[model samples]
Target: MSGTKPMGTDEHDAARTERLRKAMRCLEGGQFAQARVLIEPLCDDRRADVILAHALAGSGRSTRAARMLCRLAHDNPTARHPAQDMMTLLLRHSRLEEIEVTLRATLRQTPDDIRLYDQLGEFLLLHGRTDEAIEVLIEGCRRHPSALRTGNLLAVTQNETGEAQKAQALLRHLLSYHPQSAMTHANLAHILTVDNRMDEALHHHARALELRPDDPHIHLNHAMTLLKAGRHAQGWPEYEWRLRIPGRLKYPAERLLPTLRQDSDLSGQRILILSEAGLGDMLMYLRFVPALVRRGARVTLQVPREILPLAARIYGVERVIDPLRPVPAHDWHCPFGSLPRVLGQTSDIIGAPIPYLHADPHKVLVWEDYMPPRPGLRVGLVWGGASRPGVAQAQAIDRKRSMNLAQLAPLATVPGLYLINLQRGQHARQMIDIPEGMQLYDPMDDVRDMDDTAAIIMNLDLVVSVDTSIVHLAGALGRPVIMMDRYDNCWRWQSGRSDSQWYPGLRIVRQDRPGAWDGVVARVRDMLLPARPDNP
Candidate 1:
């Protein structure tokens, strides 16, 4: 405000000008309440008022802001952009009645602003008004055929609404002109992955990485491609890049021997190993902890507060530190996953001991007392995962990849074998869908996390799950687990192999083609059917 130029000769005009500048500064600093205080009286200038309303809307004061913007738009009939912005704010925030009024009024004012139409369409899609969104976006695309954002959003809508071919066509058309568009490449790669075209997805993701080398998203996608393509040697490094990605919680910084030279001595030194990422990843990499302990380092590991009590009881570590507590001092530190690189891992050196990692016996005993006994061979089932942000986000709810509760009901009737429910969250609702006459053990109703989940898993004879964290959990425990995978299984499992470099006791049941879980399930049934002797 101090550096502001006078907008007009009068003192009032100059004062208003300075006030607007102050408001702009406040808005940029995310102090919207202060911005509103400065800008509220400046509604006399139509342009200034519109900008202020936009600031308010962005700050989550949508109701008052939307009304003010609408009024400002009405006062100046020629200001279509502000009117559109107001309508968008209404569509995003206002009640349904207000949204309808805003939409109709805005459309009547500018019947040809295709971007406005696109915004309304996107709103409709978000609110589950799919049919309306599709109709509107289709018309907008027809009018503004070159609008890349509109086309991309429309393509996603189409894909979700069961028009995969149309979505593919729209994305492909966009790619024709914007050949180097990283977003387009990523979206196309997603479609290709669903279609079982792993090679095509890999190429497009590679192209995306070339276009935006530093984008963590593209790097993650590339890592997914490599994992899916059975190139684990290169994939794990890029996968570790999540820690440095913007907006993600960074691994707690610590002083360390920045360079762990090949000849570094670690005899009797106290080391801190901090867990990063999800519960599944922590479990997956715990196999390498014993290696650190063997190096004569007294390993004190840190994990999320919730998992600390259980992790403390895990084998191979002298102590477990909950990050919520004051961080204990150590000679050197590294993230949980970085141990592989620090220990100089190569393709030849899996260095993994099956069942090397162990949870607390006390907790396992606690779960054991709660688990109900079944008649015969005990089998655990987990068909879904906690929603992950990257590639696994889309795969999180694939009914095609997961065994339908009803489809699995038949397994329950198999004599002498009991089905245990190990799946969690929204997917756990499938429990109600289980057919009568099948015994289901559901100790997970009170189980809080992987530690509890691991305890329950210890009591079961076998674990059958789709690609999920539980698969990793069961494998780390050196339990016999069947991993039912999509045709192009996750890269960690690799290609054309039943054995995994990550887990020794795991067996893979893979789909022959895209969305072909029926065959995979049938193979699983074949393997389990004979083991259940009382089936006759």
Candidate 2:
């Protein structure tokens, strides 16, 4: 203590870096005041500007942060952090023109920067400019020949945009050049899985796992492959890795119920099941509740309020509460998605079947005029699924699952079918664009929730929809439904089958090719107007 030494340049720099890290952690936790205090001292350091911008934004000065980030991005054209942070901020505000200008100007300033290309491609993709996004990513790959991520992005975009063969070829080429790339292997596995090439997909998945044994993403992909092929026993165990993946997990692993053995008895025990994922997932998995209830266990559901009115009446569900309520006293707590893994011993049990969900009699009567109270066959149509703006993976899936309502113009001209608008969210606006002569009965403005939707659905003769929550609602209600299945089907639909394994008698009109909904629509039209023809 008696001897004092001055801090050298390296030690001083190290101290500043640690301080910046602490500031970043504070920003992540939204302790904006503390982050600002820690970061203001480092304003002169270029590395700290993004963190400072975030701190400034969270502390009631978003405009200042935006201007600061824009200045930082313009000043440091080749730097990744400022540009990416600025892009993220611009996306949240949907300032499309400014985002394009900033990214293009920065790319011109530093054409060799790979991160700018990725950022611009992502921005374009988010805005539904898929063609431009593909071109940008392709050029990025051409320029940065050694860049793995750009090439992967191009391949994935190609796959999603109805060029599956081209995507497969590009991935194979990437593997030839970069044989050791685990991501390329995993991506190839996914494409093959979607193509129904189960054995080949499993091989690539195994290779990916061997290369990166602890990677949760590879493990999750592997799980999807096995489950898609109906290898449930193996799939369920690998699926446990989902809890370890970031963003996918809704709750902490410690709080989740431990694995319940196949033979274990929960006689008189109470269990709480927490909801996870989108409404469609909730509807699909809720069928398993009866399997749990049959074990002499009392089941409580913590779910979205939208489903509360319907879930409250499921045969075996003892109680249903909105997620805002504190989890009531229970012996075991499990994620809603976990029921299948824990209760596979009773696999044959399909729970309560055919109209497991019922509409309120009053709501049904109220909706008597919902579809023109006539003798004509009424059909419900849902052209789109839910929107998840910030979630890139989910957004990509939705693009594939959704279609323009205009494509159904062919059916608008069909005979004796009264099309009803069950479409919701931003997609419902497409009702105005339907064929001029076709009148769609829309009573959705007054509809409240799933229970209300179910009541309306019961008034229809059948439901016709894409892979949306509406399909699950119709199927679970035991209503005849024609699922407009995408070419790359979901895992539950299995591979190359017209009939559903889950919903028997559910007619599936699958696309002959990816993003080729025209074929599907044509098939559905033909089915509706069968060759038997007692008509005009």
Candidate 3:
């Protein structure tokens, strides 16, 4: 041996291994600064790059660390860890454009990386770029023919974009190979539900539940499918799983009031009704309050402030308190949505009654002066509802149930109908381009609360609206409403029926296809045109 030791000598190799072991220990112990110091000298080693990047990220230099990881991933195409870390950092910062660029570049170098395609496609879909996501996933399926995950995601995106037939085919193909996958069955079930193939949807839903009995998302989907098929007897119990789903309120059952049981005798029990779900849901379920009262239970309603005044007007509610305020003591509690299940209500009982909610007589008279006092029919229009950007559920609802005010241009051609704008929030600004000679009134400014909204609805001859709280309010007041429903409407509306059992006075005009508001608006116009007092 020479006087100088070789680079691969036992002593040199042992020292290098010891150094790496200590660095890993420091990193595992959250000693990021120490780990970084130990690992920086070994940055030239390909194996040390990932550890160095993690250390740098842990030390709060995430941007610099992200750059390092991206370079590492680019240089090492076969190393999945570096690429995954880089994508994670990019996603945490919402650098979607950067992620797209980085993923596309990496895919060019390593076209066989199925995960990259899945990640890119999911990111695109989540950000509302459905068409682009579909393209990416389709390519991914072609490259990785046997990849079940990629195939499932592609089918889901396809269903979301109204390509249900394509999604159905893809899911069926996946099921043929991976029949044990719970997610695949769930995706197929959802597509079938959208296609109104309820029997087949239910079969798939049952199979999915059998595979993954504890999956809340699967249970929630099953509930919706059953409800959509007008099978409420089985649906309501499954629907209760919503409270247990992630991202929803997760208060412990013990910490909150005791849940009222279906078979419980409540002749003198003090029951609390917690207002759950959205404003529309509260309005829709308010009918059950009187039903509870009829059972001789003293009902106390906890509601949002906006609906406090209106909720207080319910005939048998002993006290109406805002949820923001201190809660009153009660023997048991039930969410508004649970009433149907507790009452064991089925579709047959949906025809019970209407006008469950009453407007303030005084306020109704006051709104009379605010009306345009025209001779023609006064129709209320709610083109949109509240939807914050970036929330998937809200975005999906807005896309399905809302339309641009300009899309309602066809309605302007119909004469003798004064279009009263009941649209609130930012969507009211859309009324700027009302067609010339169209009699339109904007009273959204004075419509302060649900009471005011109810009062205004009472003045209109017909309320034409999307599936929003206003429609529920109008229906609850027994007003004749023409609901401009989406293809995938809420469970209450059901399917293939012009009339609703929940609101007997309401007539639904739904889209034959998703995003086809033009047809819906045209139908409304034709219906209005033929029925115009001056027409025939």
Best by TM-score: 3
Query: Can you write out model 1's per-residue Cα lDDT over 1-536, one digit (the tens) per residue?
Result: 48888556698777877888888777666565687778877777776777677666655566666566556656665445464654554444444555545554555555666656766775675556879888888887888787677788888767654466788899999888788788988887866665556788888888888898888877877777776675666766776566567755443455543434545557888888876767766767666666666667888988876556656655568888777766677887778766655654432235567775666677888887866675567889987766544343354345445666666665665667777788887778977766677677788779876778778888889999988778887887789999888764555676777778788788998877656666777778777875446643
Q: How well does candidate 3 match the true structure in TM-score terms?
A: 0.84
User: By descending TM-score, how would the candidates be arranged?
Assistant: 3, 2, 1
Across 1-536, the per-residue lDDT of candidate 2 in tens digits comes to: 67779899999999999999999778666576798899988988667877787666656555566566666766766556366775675455455665677677667766777877898898888787989999999889888776777788888888888787788888888888888899999999999998999999999999999899999989989999998898888887788788787776665566566656556677878889988888988887788777678777898998899988988887778899998988778877887777777666555334456667778889888888666767778989888888788787888788788999888877777778889989889888887677667778888999889999999998998899998888888898889999998888888787878887667748888888888999999878877773465633
**For model 3, how does the per-residue alpha-carbon lDDT over 384-464 read when each residue is reduced to its tens digit?**
988867688787778778888888888878777778889988777877776555657888787778889889989989999
Which runs of model 2 end up more than 4 angstroms from their true locations? 1-82, 85-102, 247-263, 530-536
RMSD of 1: 6.6
Which rank order by lDDT, best down to worst?
2, 3, 1
The model with the greater TM-score, 1 or 2, is: 2
- For candidate 1, give the lDDT of residue 534: 62
Clash pairs, candidate 2, are none
C-alpha TM-scores of all predictions: 0.74, 0.82, 0.84
- How many clashing residue pairs appear in each of the predictions shown? 2, 0, 0
For model 3, give the RMSD to the true fold: 5.9
